[model samples]
Every structure is written in C-alpha cells, then in structure tokens.
Target: MSILPLLIIVPFTFIILALFIHHVRIKNALSLILGLTNFALAFYILKIVHNAGMLKTQMGSWPAPYGITLVADRFSAFMIFISAIVFLAVTLYSIQSIDKERLKNNYFLFTYGILMGVNGSFIAGDIFNLYVWFEVMLMSSFILISFGGEKAQLEGSIKYLILNLISSFFFVAGIGILYGKMGSLNLADLALKFSRIGDFPSLFEPSLILLLVGFAIKGALFPFFFWLPASYHTPPPAVSALFAGLLTKVGIYSLIRIYTLFLHHYDYFWNPIILWMGILSMVIGVITATSQFDFRKILSFHIISQVGYVIIGLAFYTISGLAAAIFFLGHNMLSKTNAFLVAGWVHRERNTLSLKDLGDMFNKHTLWGILFFISAFSLAGLPPLSGFAGKYLIIKAGIESNQIIVAMVALFVGLFTLFSMTKIWIEVFWKNTKNEKNDSEQRIKSNGLPYRYMITASIILALSIIVMGVWAKPIAEFCETAATDLLNNQKYINFVLG
Candidate 1:
C-alpha cells in the first residue's frame, strides 16, 4: 500500500503494457498520463516530507534488518521530484519528436523502464538494492541511446555499454566484499556496524575505494567520462535530454549517499583524490568543449565540466560544502535539460547539429534564440540565473574550507564555460551562412514552430533556473536541511527501519 514501492512498480507496469500495445496514439497517451501522475506523486511526497521531515515504508510488515525498506528523506525527495518533473517534460516532448516507424512502442517501454530505475535508486534503502537499480537504469539507458539503431548510435552505445558494464562489475564486487565482512546490505545497519568496529581500517578502506570508484565511473568523473561524449550526442534529442538531465545525476546521488552515510570514516583517503579529479575534469572538459563543432557534443563536455564543480564542493566535506553541492545538482539538472531541449529544437529546424553547418538562427527564431541564450548563460553560471547561485555558494564554501585553489579552479572553469557558450552562440546564431541551401526552410515554413511544446517546456525550466537564483535563500535553507540529514544518517535509518 505504500507509495514508495509504487514509484518503481507503476512505471514498470506501464512499460509492460506499452510493450504489448501496438497503437501509437494509445502508447503516447498512456505514457504521458503515467509520467504526469508519477510527477504529481513526487510533488505530493515532497509535501509529506516538508510536513513530516521524512517518510519510510517497509516492503512488508517486517522490521528493519529482516525486511526491505524504502525511504524518502529531504535529499531523496528533492532528487525524486526533479527526476519526475524531467521525465514528464521529456515524455510530453517525445510525442512529436520521436520517429514512429523507427522506435514505435519500444521507446515508451524503455523510457518508462529508465524512470523506474531512476526513481528506485533514489528510494532504495540497501546497497545491493541500489546496485540493482543502477543496473536497471543503465541497461535501459543503453537501449534508449540506441533506440533508432543508427550506425553512429550503435557505435556510441557499444562504448557506453562496455564502460558501464565494467563499472557494474566493480560495484557488484564491492557489494560482495562488504556483505562478506559486515553481513548486512542495509545502509543504516552498515553504518551502525562500521561505527562499532574499531581496528578494521584496511578492509573497510578497500571496500570503500571499490564502491566509490564504481560510483565515479557511473558519474562520468574525469577518467571514466570518455564514454559520455561518445554516446550522449548520438541519441535522439528527446532521449539525449532525458539522459543528460537524469543519468549522471543518479551516479552523483549514489556517490553522495554512500559518502555521507556509509563512507564518512574514509574521508581523508578519498577527499584529496576527489579534489584533484574535480580540477582536472573542469580543465579538460572545458577545453574539449571549446574544440567541439557539434552542439550536443559541446553540451556533453560541459556536463562533465559542470559536474566537476559539484564534486569539488562535496569533496570539501563541510556542511556548507555539501549543501552547495546539492543546490548545484538541482540547478545543473534543470539547466542541462533545457540546453538539450534547445539542441533538439535546433536539430528539428535545421536537420543538423553541427555548429559549422548552422547559422543565423537568432535573427529568424527569436524566441527560441532567447531561450537558448538564457539556458546557456545559466549553464555558464552567469548572474541572475540558478547556475550562478550554485557556483557562488560552492565557491564560497570552498574558500571557507581553506581550499583557495579549488575556489579559483571553479571561477576559471566558469569563465571557460562562458567562452564555450559564446562559441556556440556566435557559430550557430550570429554568423551568416554562405549556403542556406541545405537548411530545411520548407519544413520550417510548413510546420510553423515545430517544437513549440518542447520550447515552452524548456522555457518553464529556464524560468525556474532564474527564479531559484533570485530567491536563493529558501532553496539554500532546504539544501542545508538535506545536507544535515545526509551527514547525520540517523533520520534516514529511523524513518526507513523504525
């Protein structure tokens, strides 16, 4: 009867139904209804959290150590809410964007499957369950990435699949080791048990390292990020938007959860590695972004770079730092999804995503041009946008933690991100094309704003970015509470297992 289990069950139920239903209209209608309902439930969960602080439901009538548990703390609630909103928007946009003949019913099934994985990951109360959810999400994502079965998509998906599978192995191995040592996969039980154990430093450290590395691979951090750019741009824009918005954030959420709840004792060992990785990823990601001629590729690289800022904040391991990271995670998800939506619109109009082949869009598509600019500026951390608010908070926290180098890296990375954005703006919007012959003017003329709904959705998200920036205080307070809950751990355990 608990809603927590429904978050996973409902989407999967629809996925099964969609697989058998061949009618496209029914498929789209059902998918949209399900996505919206799920989003509403996520919002309702947020309301419950606001009133009660945390919500938990045991899978059966059994107690903590004996039964599976689902939890909705402030952090989990925020992530679930964001994932639901993005899933709904993407589902609505997919109605016009997806190719009926190529993907058909399979697209909806995979999409819903991905939602199930994402939502389950947020609420899972045990490490083994978390791994199961992560695999479900990743496998669904692989299918989504190669949905249309294009050559490029197939190639990219292979690379992505290989890397993620490797990461999954590491994750499974780490869980096995942990279970062997602790005899419990429940996060609360593990935390309590680890606290009681005194001289088992070596065993705990290796297990923590293995688990974190697996999360890092999933997160697309530094060395494990090559797969992201290889495959992210190959998918359809709607699929790409969902992947960009939610997938990496899942990895980040897992890393944050494990670090705060189960691996706090190993901060000295992990923090330094995370700090350097953040700096290296920021520099490398921006540089690669600058070199990219394709719009989606640039945005993909920027995703890596922006993630570095979040990692840097969390690596500092202070209350303010963790709070800043959470705020940035929310901001980045909204802004990144908007950016991909813009890319999709541009592709729909021009039939191409290459910056070199696109030109003079700003003068013709003024509304979309403005929306793109807003999203890009937000991603670059420009003032009066949510991105800036997040960057400011993280930088402030870094400085307060006496990590001056990290603060400076964040600032420089922001400027470089701006440079990358400007490059896209000038190439695609400002510059005049010598050959407009290849441009799909006839389609644009006939359709007359083909991606209108998608554009509207993007604008709403962009507005949220601005609003969150202007009213930072309330969001900051929420993030602070979430961070404290993560650090304290008892609230999550009590709510889930009590």
Candidate 2:
C-alpha cells in the first residue's frame, strides 16, 4: 500500500510479466506503463514529503530493529524523483532505438530491474539491504551493458563485472566487520552503538576506510576509474547515456550517505584524500578525453572528470559545498545524458564515431549541430547554463572554505573541459574531409534525421539543463535542505526507524 514498497514491487512485477509476453509491442507498452507508474509514485511521495517533511514505511507491523524499513527523506526522495524522470526519458528514447531481435524482452527486464535497485537503494534503511540493492543494480547493469553480445560489449562487461565483484567482496567484508563490532545491520543501530563504545575510534577507522574504498570503486574515483572508460563506450548509446547519467551518481549518493551518517567523525581523515583524488581525476579525465577520437569514449572520460567536481564540493564539507555538489549532480546528469544522446545520433548518421571519418556534419544537419553545440557549451560551464551555476557554487564554496588551491585546480579543470569540448566540436562539426566530398556534392539530400524519439528525449533534457540554470534559487534551497538532512544523521535515523 505504501509508496516505498511500490517503488520496488511494480518494477519486479513487470519484469516477471515480461517473461510471459510474446508480443514485443505489448512488452514495450507494459514496460512503459510500469515506468510511468513508478515515476508518478515517486512524485506523489515527493509531494507528501514536501508537505509532511519525511515519509517512512516499515514492512509488515514489525519495528525498525526487527524488520525492513524504507525511508524517504528530502534527500532520498529528491534522488528518486530525478531518477524516475531519467527512466521515463530513457525508456521513451529506447522505443525506437533498440533492435527487437538483439535485445527483445530481456532488455526491458534488465532495465526495470535496475530501476528497482535504484529505488531500493534510495529508501533502504539497513546496511545489508543497501548491499543487496547494490548487487541487484550491478547485475542488471552487467546484463544491460552486454545485451547484444557484441565483442566489445562482452569485453567491457567482463571487465566491469570482475572489478565490481571484487568491490562487492570488499563491501561485504566491511559490512561483516561492522556487524561483528556493533551486532546490528541496521544503520541507525550501528551509529548509536558506535557513539557509545569507548574504543569506537580504533575499530571504526578501518571499517570506515574499507567502506569508503568500496564506494570509491563504485563511484569510479581516481585509481579505481579505469573500468569506467573501458566499459562505457561499448554499450549502445542509449544504454551508455543512461549509465553515464545515473550509475556513477548512485555511487556518489552512497558516498554522501556513508560519510554524513556513520562516519561523520572521520571527516578530517577522508576529506583531504577525496580532495586530492578529485583534483587528479579531473586533470586525468580531461587529458584522456582530449586524446580520444571516438565520440562516446571522449564523453565517457568526461564522466570521470565531472564526478571530480561533485567530490570536490563534498570534500569542502560546508553547507554551500554540499549544496553545490547536489546542484552539480543534477546538472551533470542532464548535460551528460544529452551529450551521449547527441553522440548516438551522430554515430547513427555517419555509421562511425571516429572524428577522422566524420566531418562537416553541421553543414548537413544544422539542427543536430546546434543542439550538440548548446549541450557541449553547457557541459563546458558556459555562463547562463546549468553547468556554470554548479561550477560557480562549488568554486565559491571552495573560497569560503579557504581551500584556495583546490579552487584553482577546479577552475583550471573547467578551462580544460572547454578545450576538450572545442576539440570535439571542431572535429565533428567544422572540419572538412575528403570523405564528405561526394555527400556534399549531392544537390538534394533527404534529412534522414536520426530517430525522432531520441531527438525529442534529448531536447527535453537539454531544456531542463537550461531551466535549472535560469531558476536555480529554489533548487539551491532544496539542495541546502537535503544536505542538512543528510549531515544530521539523527534526523535521518529517527525518520526512518522511529
């Protein structure tokens, strides 16, 4: 009856129903219906939270310490709402993009499974449940990434699987250690026990480190990010776009959750490490992106770099800093999704993502060129766009925190991001090539625009980026409120388990 259970149940039910449907259209329709219903429920919950502050639902009549608890605070509800919007957009885009024979019903099942996992993660109150949700999400992602069984897809999926499994092992080990020390898997219970124990500092430090490392691997932070670029470029563009937009952010969401809740006292130990890694990730990702010729490869690398900005904000540990991080998280999701969608369109048109092979596309498809330009400029943090607003807030936070060096690094990284975007722009949009000679010579070429559905979905995301930038005040306020809830663990635990 509660919205929390529906978040997981609807998707799970649809996935099971998909197994019995023989008609592709019926399956697709069913999936879309489920996605829309889930999206609606997420908004309904958001409205309830907005009016009533927070919402919690315990499974059955059992209390928190004995039964599963689902909690939707301002922060979790906000993530679920955004994630629902993204699922709707991606599902709509996939209607025309995916091949029936290659992906079929299994695609929808995996997609829905992922949605369930993401929703579960957003609401889960137990550490063990969080781990379960993470594995569910990861398994679905593995299947989705390797859907068509292409050589590239298989290779990427394999690498991703192995790395993630290793990360999962570490995660489980950390959870086991925490349970051994505290005798409870419930997050709030552990926090209480941790605060009361006299020798908590010594025992807590290693467990926290292991937990942070596990999350860092998932988030694709520096030294653990090689799998991201290697695997992300192999999937179909829509899948790539969805993964780029949502997956890493889940890791980020977990990091924010862990640090602010159980490990608040460990801030001094981890913040500097996060700060340095953020800087290194930004510099390295941009540099690697500039060196790549494949459009998707470049975009994949940029995902790593942009995540750096989010980490930097959290590292500052100020209200403005966390708020800026949240703003950037939303902004980056929109911009990156649009970028990958545009890249997919370009690849569809030219049948190649190589910059050397595709050129002067702007001359033929002006609309796509313009759209790509807007998205790219926004991604580069141009003024009056969503990206700029986030960057400004993060930089301002850095200044306020007296982290002058990190602020300078962030500014420099923004310039490099611009340079990488320009590189892609000149190569794909403006460069003249002999290969285009015959195509250009034709007097009348039919538009043959890449899938209209995809374009429409991408345009919606681009518009959101612009709108979020133009009217940032309310969103900023929301981020601040969410950050306050996140940092104040007592509020979160009481809301979930009371």
Candidate 3:
C-alpha cells in the first residue's frame, strides 16, 4: 500500500528532474531509466496483490472514509504493470523518434506528467480522487498534443480539449451529487451505503448516467468518439501510442471499477444501455475505419472498435465475460500501441501513411513489415495470437450467457477487423509502387528518425504479444482472478474498510 504512492511520485520526481535537464540525450536517458524503474515497482505491486488480497493505504494517516485513499486490487495492479511496460517502450523509442526541439522543451516532463495521472487513476479508491487524476492526465495531454504548435495539431487539440472539458464537467457534477447524497466519497464506504440503502431514488439514476457519459467520452465510445479520430493521428507516434495504450484504458478501468463496485446492484438500469453502446461502438468504429486511408486514423478507429468488445463483457455482467473484457483490454493496448509505432516507422521512412501513396514495406523493410504483420494479425484475431485468445473467451462467454446477438456481433466484428488489417497489409506492405527509390537512396534523401530505436521498442511490445498468446493460460487465469475480485464487491469493501 505504501508502495502505491511511489507509483505516482516516481514519475512525478522524474518530471521535476526533467525540468532542470536541457540536453536531449540526458533527458531521454533519465526518462528511459525512470520508466524501467516504474515498471519494476508496478511488477512488485502486482506480485503483492496476487499473493495478498487488495492493499490499501490512507494518506496523512487518516483512516478510510476521512482520508485520501490509494488502493490496489489485482485489476489495478495489472493495469499499472502493463502501463509501465508501454511507458518504458515508448520512452526508449522517443529517445530517437521525438524531435530534439521538443525534447529540449520539457517533453519528458509532460510525458511523465501523463504517466503520473494514469497511475493515479488506476489506484484511486474513490470517485472524487479519480476525477482529480483525470484532470491531471487531461492537462498534461493538452500540452503534449499542442506542443509542436502545428496547425493540424492545434486543431486536433481543440476538439480533444472541448470534448474533455465537457467530460470533466459531467464528471465533477456527478461526483458532487454522489457526495451530496451519500455523505461520503470513499469507494468502499459508498458501496456499503448503497448496498444497505436498499431502494435508490429517481435522481440517483441520472447521477450515475452523468458519470457514464463522462467516462464514455474519455473511453471513446461511439457518438462521443469523433474527437479521438480527429486528434489522435496529429501527435507524434510516441505520444499517440502512449495515448492509445493508457488514456482510454484508464476510462475503461473506471467504468469497470464503478460498475463492479458501486453500480452492480443497479444492473437492471444500465445493462441495456451497456449492450447498445458496445454494439454500436463495435459496428460503427470498424466500418468507419475501413474508409480511412491514413494508417494512424484506421488504428485510432480500431481502438473504438476494440473498446466495444470490452464493454460487451461488462454488459454480460458475469465473471467469465468480465475476465474476457480484462484480457481483451490488455491485448488491445499492446497491439494498438505496436500498430501505431509501426505507423510511426512508416511515416518516418516513407514520408506518408496514406494507403494510396505507400507500398513495398516487405520489399524494403522486411523486419519492420513482419513486426506490423504480427501486431496487425493479432489485432485482427488470427489464430494462436493474443487477440484470438481474448475473442475466443468473450464469444464463448457470450454464447453460454445466451447473448447470441452479442456473440455473433463479436464474430462479425472480428471479420471486419481482419478486413481492415488486410487493407493496410495490401496497401502498405505488399503493393509495389512506381518510381520507388532504393533503400540506401531513400535513407540518404530522408530526414527521418533512425530506425534502430523505434524497431527495438516495437519488437519489445511485439514479443509480449507473442508470449502472451503462446503462454496465455497463466494470463487468462490472472484475468479470471481479477474479474472475480471485481464482481465480489463485499470482498473489496471489507479489505478497504477493515
């Protein structure tokens, strides 16, 4: 529990250190070292959670309902650990990929700032603190997104800012109402209170709904996901991959956290809505992605499509379903980040990601193309990959639950996902282009970032996808354990309050 605070403080300390470092190499070195350290700490926390149950610490030595609380359950620890892995990979890649001008401009600080908020959100034990952490993440992201001050970046940042502001507004308003009625902001305390309260008021439903909208926007669910496609591709790939890996997942984490803890008893009220949201996000996100020619844009939309699958698990409100959701969420984070990193490499080398203008990745950069193939096919749910395992679990659970429509949608979504992947594969990797320059000549003419660092970063994540796929039983077991914990709110409440 004491270690939980250090998760935030570690990155925060690096942010302070980064402020004083002007040299790009030193900043990059510091960032990479700290990122690895953060991952180690999170791994330690995960082991602790797996061995023990949930761990809780009260800030300022105040107990439970009166103090700021940080709690780590299996789910949160898993998320923090995965977040660390991506942070380290991105940091290493950014050393070479991020512009030197941006590196000198406290880029590492802003990056660390975002990590702090993400870690904070995962461990926060209450809604109000979660809201605070969301703001921290949003503020850092705003700066990072607009750092280059490119016209496209600024424009994208505006859409991101406006939607997030609305989200924050809804979030705070809901928090206000939650505290007003419950007289407490502690998660376990609220769970106990709501459980014991028996009947809920008419207004209580709206408060929860408001919180849902706020998280929906942050998580990029349909009808609220337009901001994502508009803005995500505008940033540098490192920033885009970080955002892809952690930002929306945090929102999804909150959704799972809130629903499993405080909102489970009210399932009748929210389950229908959850199903519709999941279905629409899956269908709309994938179909829209097919129309996009830009590499990053397609991946950004796929984020929405994949998020829908997780939501469907929640909609089932079963342990098996939630386990699948958690597993799928983890898989998607790695796959999506790697995909964007591949796009980054392409955009760097080919000077474009427009499908019509790009080709011959296999001919020129066979290794990088192979990396993309692993990530893309895994994302498309090919056999014996991480995506396949996750989808198999979800569809099986959906079928057993008699959610035939949900199961069918999951299957169809996978097919379209494959189609989307094939489109990118054919256009970017296989198709031959006219008037193509030789590799050496291309390198001579290009002002692109060097390939070694980026390839190393992508390979680290790519290997993870393969390892998780081949050695999936243990991971699946862990997800099942985490899912059980989430469903058993009494256990969570007892651990936090005791």
Give one digit per residue, the lDDT tens place, for model 3 in 272-384. Answer: 88889999999999999999999999999999999999999999999999999999999989999999999988888877889998887787678999999999999999878
Candidate maximizing TM-score: 3
Per-candidate local distance difference test: 0.86, 0.84, 0.90
Better of 2 and 3 by lDDT: 3
Q: What is the per-residue lDDT of model 1 for residues 52-106, given as tens digits with 9 covering 90 to 100?
A: 7888877776788667778888888999988887888788878877887744646
Give stretches of model 3 more than 4 Å off: 437-440, 446-450
Q: Which ranking of candidates, highest lDDT first?
A: 3, 1, 2
Find the 10 residues in a row with the least total lDDT in model 2.
441-450
Q: Estimate each model's TM-score.
A: 0.96, 0.95, 0.98
Better model by TM-score: candidate 1 vs candidate 3: 3
Candidate 3 TM-score to native:
0.98
C-alpha RMSD by candidate, in order:
1.7, 2.0, 1.4
